[model samples]
Target: MNTPELGWFKSSYSSAQGDDCVEVAVTEQSVHVRDSKDVTRRPFTMDLNGWAQFVTSLGSN
Candidate 1:
């Protein structure tokens, strides 16, 4: 998707502190993720199921 089509959401953990973090967006077809520190950088995309697993893993970390 193009930059304008993305609806980014910064992780609450990232916003709580000023440190470097990542942002994530759940798109219609896939999940879009990017560095919270750099909006212009390329983002990583993953399928819905992959995103779910990734989040599940994060909770365990």
Candidate 2:
């Protein structure tokens, strides 16, 4: 996928030191995720519904 075209952004909680940075970009049907430090790697993609469910699950932990 053309990750750069998607305008990925890191979490607001991300620090300037750049550790543990998770970058994400929202598209109409899917959400793209990648490690900010090694963006050249292929990203993980999930459907919107799955992304929502995953986020909800994280909140429960």
Candidate 3:
């Protein structure tokens, strides 16, 4: 299946210098994650539940 085009946004925590930048796009079924500095690479896809868990886990660190 073709991935849907989404409006990706850079994380607010990303550096102003543009290094280690992370971008995310939300869709109906999943969230797409990619490196802002390397858009040519395939993105990592996660379901809503997985995405929630991942974000929650990050908050605990």
TM-score, per-candidate, Cα-based: 0.72, 0.87, 0.78
CA lDDT, candidate 2, residue 59 = 100
TM-score between model 2 and native: 0.87
Per-model tally of clashing residue pairs: 0, 0, 0
| Candidate number achieving the greatest TM-score relative to the actual structure | 2
Against the true structure, what is every candidate's RMSD? 2.7, 1.5, 2.9
In TM-score terms, candidate 1 sits at 0.72
Q: Which residue pairs overlap in candidate 3's backbone?
A: none
Model 1: CA > 4 A from native: 16-19
**TM-score: which is higher, 1 or 3?**
3
Best by lDDT: 2
Q: Please list the residue runs of candidate 3 whose C-alpha ends up more than 4 Å from where it truly belongs after superposition.
A: 1-4, 17-19
**Compared with the true structure, what per-residue lDDT tens digits does model 3 show for residues 1-61?**
2234778888788778877888889989999988877788889999999999998999999
Name the regions of candidate 2 deviating beyond 4 angstroms.
none
**1-61: candidate 1 lDDT, tens digit per residue:** 3365688777676657645887777778899888766778789989999988988999999
**RMSD (Cα, Å) of model 1:** 2.7
